[model samples]
Structure formats: C-alpha cells, structure tokens
Target: MRVHQLVVNFNATAQKLVNWKMIRFGFVLVVMFTLVCTVKSYTFQIPVEHDKNGEAYVTFDGTKHWLKDNKNLEYMDAQNCTVHLELFALPTEESNAYVSGWRLCPQEFDKIP
Candidate 1:
C-alpha cells in the first residue's frame, strides 16, 4: 500500500513537470508568433548625392538623411549605384527607423539584379 501511494505521488509530480514544460513551450511559441507578425521591415533604392558641404545624403519623403559613414560613401561611389535604404520597426515602436548605412536589402537581396 505504501509503495502504491509513493508511485501515485511520483506520477503526479511527473505530470506537473510535463504540464509546466508545455506551458513554457506554449508561451515561447506565442511570443515568437507575435514578433513575427508585428515586426516590419522594408527596403528601397534611393539616389545618394552630396550636399553643398560635400556630405553625402539621401532624401526620403522630403527628409534628408545624411550618410556619416565614410565606408558607405565609398561603396556608393565605387558601385555607382543608388543606395538601398533598409527600414524596420519594432513591435513596440509606432514609427519605422532606418537600419543604418547602405547595403542590399537583406530580405529581398536575391530578387534585385
């Protein structure tokens, strides 16, 4: 009788552990799905031109974002290609922010020639 009682308690503890693991796994999946759905990213090509002071910048929606990185300016001149601006927004952010410096679109680089 004592052995039966011990087995029952052990089974209950094992079931509780399995339930807790499942709850944790479910929470993780929910967070991942929420992030995948809420996170947004976009990329577009825009011409880079130097201002009167010889600083390179790109204009988007009437806003001039200066390129402060020397490497980006060099790459733009070397490739003679328009800059690819990557923009992304976090789940908590209301407005999108630039992903910094110039490069091919990470998510759609293969689609561009």
Candidate 2:
C-alpha cells in the first residue's frame, strides 16, 4: 500500500510539470504572434546634391533636410561625410507593419551646374 501511494504521487507531480510547460509554451507563441501582427511600412525620398568639394549633401522631399535623430544615421563616415542610402529610413515609426522611409542618394540627383 505504501509503495502504491508513492507511485501515484510521483505520477501526479510529473503530470503537473508537463501541464505547466505546455502553458508556458502557449504563452510564448501568443506573444510572438501579437508582435508579428503589429508592424507598419512607409516610404520617403532623400535628395542629394554635390557640394563645392564634390561631397554629397542630403535633402528630403518635404521641408526637413537634416537628420532628425542621430541614432537613425547609420553607416556614416563623418570624416568622409558619406552614408548608405538606407540610413534615411532609420527614423521611421513602425506601428501595425514595417514602415520605411525613402532616401534619394547623390546618384539620383541631377547636376545643378
């Protein structure tokens, strides 16, 4: 009788552990799904012009010309004053989907001179 009671208790403990693990896994999956569903996408254009030194000057389509957040500027070479085109999209806000900003690099601009 004593041996039988021990076996039954052990089985009940194991079952509870398995149930808790399943609940934890289900919770993780639900959180991941929610995150995947809420992202936004956007596009912007950046205009570039050649300065007197032949370096690229970045310009935006609207009134903004300079970068709003320093964190958004990636792959920048301050010494060379150059950056990748996609850096312009770094400041964008993502809500329901992945939002992207448009950037016009120097190659896309026409020579003013």
TM-score of each: 0.41, 0.39
Show the lowest summed lDDT stretch of 10 residues, model 2.
Answer: 90-99
Candidate 1: where are CA atoms >4 Å away? 41-56, 69-113
Please provide, for model 1 over 1-113, each residue's C-alpha lDDT reduced to its tens digit, 9 standing for 90 to 100: 99999999999999999999999999999999976654333333565655576655666656666656433332233334445453332233222233454443334555656
Per residue, candidate 2 scores C-alpha lDDT tens digits across 1-113 of 99999999999999999999999999999998865553221234444444454433354333233433333543433343234333333223332222234332443234534
**Residue 43 of model 1: what lDDT?**
34
Candidate 1 has its poorest 10 consecutive residues by lDDT at: 88-97
lDDT of each: 0.56, 0.48
What lDDT does candidate 1 reach at residue 12? 100
Candidate 2: Cα lDDT at 26: 100
RMSD of each: 12.3, 15.8
